[model samples]
Target: MRLSRYFLPVTKETPADAQIVSHKLMLRAGLVRQTAAGIYAWLPLGLRVLKKIEQIVREEQDKAGAVELLMPTIQSADLWRQSGRYDAYGPEMLRLVDRHEREMLYGPTNEEMITTIFRDATKSYRDLPRTLYHIQWKFRDEVRPRFGVMRGREFLMKDAYSFDLDEEGLKQSYEAMFVAYLRTFARLGLQAVPVRAPTGPIGGDLSHEFHILAETGESQLFYDAAIDDVTREELLAADASTIARLTRLYAMEAEEHEKVAECPVPAERLRSRRGIEVGHIFAFGTKYSASMGFSIQTADGGQVHPQMGSYGIGVSRLMGAIIEASHDDNGIVWPDSVAPFQVGLINMRADDAACSAAADNIYKQLETAGVETLYDDRDERGGAKFATMDVIGLPWQLVIGPKGLEKGVVELKRRASGEREELSLETALARLTAR
Candidate 1:
């Protein structure tokens, strides 16, 4: 993508209303624009990052034996009514009356709808276990939506519902999603700790929320420091035993920690930190199924409600969470996996014939090598181009300047470590493509 043709509307001045680092950086970096309060228009650059995150979530879900299927944003109010939660859901749900005078709603969650769908499709015990997921936009009427996408009224979410015939089956499905969540966060370059959390509106005795540790998080957490010792490799290949070990480790929100009579974690082993919630899973058993009239026939010819679980990852909120966890003073330092573009190819002196030619050639080479490179071919100053590159936070910045071109070298800089080295054109190409 060429900056000259791109629609990035970056600004140097931070908006006065922007309160958090991720919110401010997202605006300054031209990742998103506020269309309404608590709602955003994801610009091209931001959309790329979002899609990358969504794909990773999708892949991890698929690996965990969950099948993918898209669900609609709008759901029938009758679905909630059947589940005995229409009025119970409260004002956060955007309830409305359609043109036909039928009660309707923008679904905040799909428990009721998914239960109805699964129930109508499966009648016998043959379809005992199934996990289906969808990535879709969800809306909640937040009274005070703030911190950009971190607490937005409208956001994208990956929600999966698991249906099982018995309690034991639900446990297996929950564990699969638990492992999937760990691997998903690890793949996104986040150190997310799974902490036992209240089921709240979801209504389940078993629930865990995956929170990514960040200084600016909304929740204070008390956890066993050993949770951090579980390596990324282990998380990627985590099994039921891994889940058991992690669950046994003491981890809780401040609210939950306050309720405990005595903490099991030794003071030395207890680590308190702030964390932002990114993913949550609930083993709600028959909450939705039973209430929504979803039941299958048993082998003994008895009707039984299917045990169910719901897993959710904040797909759009993850962008803000990642920025909160990863950004520095300059701007967002995006992880390679979720970076909009892997490399920023800047023509430091676009007006200079030599610089332009070299940058164009290098951009071609990078693209041909299957590297997602954003080429800054605009007739802009070197400093401005460099600033844009830094703010956007591409993993690598390849600067082709007149001076560097003359010396048969280009400046290659790594965004995370701020490491810069001069490499010959061929050498730089080889290094960038090798990965």
Candidate 2:
């Protein structure tokens, strides 16, 4: 991708309605455009980032031994009626009447639909403990949807469902999703703290909301400051005991905070911050299954309703949440794992012969090395090119200019740190690919 050929539109002025930093930044960056009060059209740059986040979620879900499938964006109201939520669910449900006056809706969640799917084929305890997931578009009609993609009406989401035999089986299946969520957030470079949250519409006895701390975040949380160093490997190496230990270690929502006598830490050491809930998991036993007649024969020759757990990650919300968690005054500082492009090749003097030649060489080398890069071959000024690249914020920047081309070296700069080092072309490529 090149600035000369790319469609990244950036604006210096922030929109007045964008009350939050992430929202403001997203609009200024030309990542999204508002089509209605709450609906947004994802531009090229935003779509690229969303796809990257989706890929990371997919990989983590696969690692957790969950199978993937696609579900429809629209569903029949008959399923919701069987679950007795057709009238109970309020305006958030985008209900409709079809040509034949049939009830229909753009699904806000897939509990009713997934239950219908499961009951249609699954009929035995042998096929118990099945986890199926899908990444698709979901619609929830928010009355006052604002904050860019953070609270959009139509957004991409990854929702997975697990079905098991009984309470004991439900607990194990819940842990599998719990572990999977931990790894998913870690791989996306988010320090998500699992906090017990109230089950809103998703009825369940057990629930956890994953929050990433940021000033512009929506959820207020209490968590251990040490969670900043949490990693995916810790979650992947976990079992039943490991899940309990990890959950018991520390963290809770504002309502669940403890004020008892315990490990004494100063008030400043106790970190309470605002965060956005990117993902949530809950175990609702026999709720949808019982309503939909999803019964299977057990060993004792009796029909039983299966326990189910649902896990959700806001695939599109993550783009905004990530920006909220990790950005500076200049622009978005995309984390290495989820950056749209790993390396940005800047030809400081794209019109000049020597600089263009050197940049072309570097771009080819990076491509051969299997690096995702954007070559800024545009005839923009050095400051303009640098600022645009900085706003997009690739993990690394390879600066090739006429002055540096004379020295037989290029400048390498890390997006996180402003420091720059001049290195031989060969050395620069080696250092980038080595890691």
Model 1 CA RMSD to the hidden true structure, in angstroms: 1.0
Residue 166 of model 2, lDDT score: 95
TM-score of every prediction relative to native = 0.98, 0.95
Q: Model 1, 302-363: lDDT tens per residue?
A: 99999999999999999999999998889999999999999999888878887788789889
Model 1: pairs clashing at backbone N, Cα or C within 3 Å: none
Off by over 4 Å in 1: 259-261
Q: What is the C-alpha local distance difference test score of candidate 2?
A: 0.85
TM-score, cand. 2 vs. native: 0.95
Residue 158 accuracy (lDDT) in model 1: 96
